[model samples]
Target: MSYLRFDKTLLTNLEESLTREVLRTNRSGAYHCSTIVDCNTRKYHGLLVIPVPELDDENHVLLSSLDETVIQHGAEFNLGLHKYHGDNFSPRGHKYIREFECEKVPTTLYRVGGVVLKKEKVFVHHENRILIRYTLVDAHSETILRLRPYLAFRSVRQYTHENAQASRHYDEVENGIKTCMYPGYPELYMQFSKENTFHFQPDWYRGIEYPKEQERGYDFNEDLYVPGYFEFNIKKGESVTFAGGISAIDTASLNDLFTYEVEKRIPRDSFKNCLINTAHQFLNKQGEESYILAGYPWFKCRARDMFISLPGLTLAIGEVEKFEVVMQTAVKAVYAFMNGETTDLKVYEMEHPDVLMWAVWTVQQYAKMVSREAAKEKYGQLLKDIMTYLADGKHPNLQVHDNGLVYANGREKAITWMNSTVNGRPVVARTGYIVEFNSLWYNALRFVADLFVEDGEFSFRLNQIADKTAVSFIDTFLNEYGYLLDFVDGNMMDWSVRPNMIFAAAFDYSPLDAKQKKGVVDIVTKELLTPKGIRSLSPKSGGYNPNYVGPQIQRDYAYHQGTAWPWLEGFYLEAYLRIYKRSAISFVERQMISYEDQMTCHCVGSIPELFDGNPPFQGRGAVSFAMNVAEILRTLNLLAKYDNQ
Candidate 1:
């Protein structure tokens, strides 16, 4: 009863296996992603996808996939699968799979004609590298293994075509060869632990159709270059290690390096441990500081996501130093933004209003995890400067009203997390007095007041501001139906039922009264609650789109309208526990079981970004989402605190 193992029956079932994906990442912002059966159904699917500094800032696909074939007495059996044009599968290697396990790392077993081989893959953290070990678990005699490397030297957003611009060449290094198809792109070094065979036959693999890309309404066909094959001979119980990296690896040290990397991993025996391990992958360090990646395969380090995810991904794991480092990095980035020192908009830019509020909330969480003195010692002046800047309306499209509520207004309505826009217009125009932003704003103000008790004048100012905001929060947002209005501006109240109101009751320093808290919880539980998570919008709301499907524009509209985000479960659970007290522990425990079960589906040991709001909420969006994983870990940490109490 291995919790994360899939037998041959499931592996051979193309429909089932292809939908499920496995992800491995290195903190260097590189990843390995493919279907459970080693088949790539999407252009983003690759054995090595890393950020190329010299190229565009986006990720690029270097090694699309590696096809391994077993040669037994001249009969060759390909243990790799690929889908070509016309919906046809070539080599059908999935049929030979014995089992797929993902407890420690992703391991696949293959049994072919009395020869049993097990393949294990691990992405080295802090480096752009992948180590794959192939062991002949059982065999009657020596067997030869041939590996063909498929190279797609293109951005992850674009499809590659057969062109003469690609240099079909290689340079020998250590125990293997290094090559770069495109000049200025990082050179790809591939090597085996033992030198056996290398043949340089360059060819093109054309008409490779990625169905997932087509489903997303994009060009689905690609052409990858195959740079010959490498042959290896192995006897029973002998293992050979293969290394693929952007830079030339120490070929003589591959065996030791692989062992060291695998041994350094903490055991993941439980779902909690699995999530903690996955959470660690979301952290990448540059220079001497650490940053949190929003999600895998696509998303980069986002201010909003990193702040929202900080508590769970770092402090919840008892990583106080790393949490401090992240906060320091964020503060430095903010200062850089203020000083106009950075043109790197993606990292330094702060557009979302709620993201700024979450930054203060993250400091409050860190204060709880460490100490007020420690937090203030590191971030006190920085926090004060940010508060002053925000209060003076230095941030774009945002200002504090004389009534004390934060107001953000812009023609571009994509200012908050519900920032899904179609064409040039926002799909959900929640421009003024957004629910979540105000709740967090109130919370942030209150937190600063409490944290800086010594600064009486500043604390008094924040308290007065918070008190004014509280009155407006209730008067403007609370509707007659007992549910909070989603947002309000000049008698135009967007009275949509959304999970954003939950934060009012979920936070420690909530402005909502007991009756208001209960009303908010009841409304959300009744409409937005699902086994997976809380939906962004209620189904009964006008313009509610229950499914997160279709092409880019369609998907964008559904993204925040009704798509269920699993990460919001943490806030919902917090509000539920706050409203119910100790009695809610059992309920929380029961609800958490579903998430643990979720680990067995979709991306094994990881979480997906969005799910359908309708019943039977299938996982949608990114295969491995960092925010979802962080939220799950955060909930488990909170659960532990409640259970202990």
Candidate 2:
């Protein structure tokens, strides 16, 4: 269950990261652009991919575009970009972004496509057909590439009710969408393109055939529309620039978000790799080091991203250079926090803010996987600095808990990465205190404590803190159902089974006995496991549903609850190996190591956002994600090498 170090393959990717173009995929299913600046030529080159939905409805194509900048109610005052007279969707103020409504058709919506970032922020200044550039971290020595995707919609209408009439008259037009240049970075110019061929979907549910691309040809949810595609041009080798579709805006308001991507994200180029060449048109970016927590496009920032992805992506692939870059990034983020920008309460978020205990724990695990005594020493200091920060109490009036869990926030709400919103309000605030963060805290301290117990500045106090936390965790978080509550309070707020416990089992630092660990694993496996991976919740839960693909609004209702997610599979498999004490993996492990190859067959390589809750179902994908591939590779390491190790 320990994190695995990177290998030659990962090192190759790391070297590539220095000169690689970006393959960016938003939540919506579209390839906005694939951009690269040839190192020899210094020409910014890019390919924008727009996957035609095989759905009979042509408008389904635009589903991706609308999702990227779909308009929402009342948001007009803030993030929405205004179109024509008064409509708006903007990327600014939309990081922690979730969904957007389909205008012509109420049933449809768009989501960003996938997860993966290989290079730093490479901005483009594009006007007319001529493209210019901004800033980039590596173009000086290595080639740089950046890409963005968009899906056009053709099917604009959907059933108002589950079994209602599918017939509705609607018009598709370019409402107010926002586009712009990176502020102060004149090399990058941005603009939104209105599709001339928007209406391509049938009025009703129909399937599609993709003769142009043989690898793809299928229908997910009969009701679909022509998807939109985002086009971006980066003049070769400039400075760093960022751009993305925004949701919610007015002409003036929407226009304001032109600087959304560039202004918000920090430039980063920690690592790289390119084993993956294509994604279900929606997702084509390869797996590298990625942070999928707080923002839509991370122009260039590191912290939670530096930590969360360290194990599965970085270490497993042996991206030592990236290892150093992310370590530096994490340290810088901690410094930024101490200097006053990051909030202790908000730092763990993948998109923004302070640092996360989970990240700290991940670093500890990553250190073990990396296994170099010197690297361990260097990161040991980094971990020690983090503990010092925790002891300093990272926020206004915040202090360490009795158990050494950092005082996350004083507010009773405001969840971190697992954040969910209903009607634009954080539904799970998860403030005041939390279980998983502390579990990570305890494990991280233990891992670090064990690292240099007899060496310099060792926190033997860390062990005492972890002990107290372990007792508190067992006494407080256990539920009557014999399963770990998703989280805890005076009364368990979530009775649903979840994969969060894998962190404990994987780390083996939590004071869990064989029984407790097995109990946690068993409960989750029995309650949340599906053929694909772990479900966010048990099917018996109220929100559980087997259907995975659908229109935007309805999809959210049951999403994560019963949807079979592949990202959690690696953790689950590792937990299985750890629990069963499998010294030598079986043939099953060998076959499953081909998880990516198998998953690619679905909707054909689009590793969906999640699979349907039911069996005998496939291709219900609304989004293509990167974590699944990364996790698969992680699992592959376990079977092909790590288990043997």
Candidate 3:
């Protein structure tokens, strides 16, 4: 059996199968996502979702789904699933699924009476294209295959309805058809490897309900335009490839193209390989610039997420070139931001107060991975400029106070990563001397000081500033309980037991002493640690929510209150090992069991953004998060280092 195989028992059950989503992406910000049974449970799910730079920043779903039918002895089997009104299902195609596995690429086996067929999907790298190959494994007689294309030419965040403005016209390209649903959008070119017939009959499928959307309290109903179906014959043991893309391709090369793309995939053969595969999926390379997408389905290239995730996503996986390219673009954007100029790169939220701090940490990882000499040769000036920028109090929100710690004013906006808002206001208004920011600030200062140790005057100045910051950090955040406070503003100190204080113990240059770091770790392990990750808040805290459910507003409220974030576990484990040394290796290894088991749940072969803080700890939020995946990989790398030692 394959590593990620599911039998008919699981494949036939809609409750289990629909929750297991699969994602395939092209490195250029296009992806194909749906459930294992080829059902789109969310509006963001589609067969071909790509970015149209001219249209807007958000991704658009060009081809919503493709319904497949098998004909044998004049009997037709509709092997496609869709949720309709009143809790109804049309086609009910999941019943025919015999097995679903994703060893190399997502492959599904179907048994429809006397015929057995296999389907495999691959999203081509660096291109806006998806190739699906259908092979007839066994058949008693000749089989006919019919494929119907569903089009939803709108942004992924919005739904479309039956409108007269939609173009019903299509043009024939060699062995295929090209259609453009609206103006200012790229024409969708769908082609087949073998000769096939194109039947253009434009009609709308109305009242298609997305249950996931309804659960999130959004509009669930949508109208999809079906432009008829393509009919073709297939002999036993024969395979045919279908390609959906924005541009026309040579029809005869479809089979070779599909095989080539499949060959490029890193097989999902083990837990580590699964994570390595998912790590590559977050990379979005455009022309000379490359970026790390925050998450799949709906996220963009946010600056904080890119910097936080860049090293683990690239360096840990041994993709050093990718690390360099992504950082090159990001460094340019950072320099542009400091100079008060607009950047051509697509990275968002460059003005966030802590992004520069994380960027320094990302470079610190590079120094550890390769060498300090190499890092200084490449990013030395960037580090100096960042420290200089922060020290001079040039940032709009971040200021260097006389106490030598950076203070941020998040009262009016959500400046930090816990940035979920209710009504354009921060949910947790963490203002004035956040713990992690100062932890990173002290670390960055000391790291740059050591890198430039030959410069006597510069290093001396940085060490003086860092010494004051260290003293101020402990005086401001450390409490009588032995653990650090979340933040301090004036006389008010937020005593919420949050995972943000973990950084104080995790970073290399921390203000906390050995006993103090151990105290913080023990408190977190007692109240906030879960089998899955570290909870955002302790249950003992008031207004603590352990579940991430209900409507959008309710989910946002619970997002950071008590939700367990897997990314935080990386730092927690790092701090654990730092305190306990080799004795903590077994405990750290045990914590990884839950994440390994999660490889087969939820998004399958990937980790989600967060999970419920309570028992069972069901995964929530984005299906494939960059930070979550990167951190897990980073932990694995850390563990391997200890094992070698």
Task: List per-prediction Cα lDDT, in the order shown.
Answer: 0.86, 0.42, 0.93
TM-score of 3: 0.99
RMSD per candidate (Å) reads 1.4, 16.9, 0.8
Worst 10 residues of 1 by lDDT: 340-349
Q: Quote the RMSD, in angstroms, for model 2.
A: 16.9
Task: Judging by lDDT, tell me the better candidate of 1 and 3.
Answer: 3
Q: In terms of TM-score, which candidate is strongest? A: 3
Q: How do the residues 92-148 of candidate 3 rate in per-residue lDDT, one tens digit apiece?
A: 988999999998999999999988999999998999999999999999997999999
Question: 1-645 in candidate 2: lDDT tens per residue?
Answer: 101112223222323311222334432323232211211100111222222234431111222222222222212112111111121223322332232111110111112222111122212212111111222222212221222222222322321112233222233324312321112211112233222222223332222211111112222222223222332322333332223322222323322333453353322211112223221111112122222222111212234533554565555666555556545545655666656675432224332323456556666656666664755667666677667666566544335677554445523434454444557654444543455665667777777777767754556677777777777777666666665655554443665566666656655576677777778878777777666767766777766766644444455555555767776777677767777766437733643543433321322222444676677534343323445545665666676564556
With a 3 Å backbone cut-off (N, CA, C), the pairs that clash in candidate 1 are none
Ranking by lDDT: 3, 1, 2
Error of 3 at 189 (Å): 0.7
Error of 1 at 56 (Å): 1.5
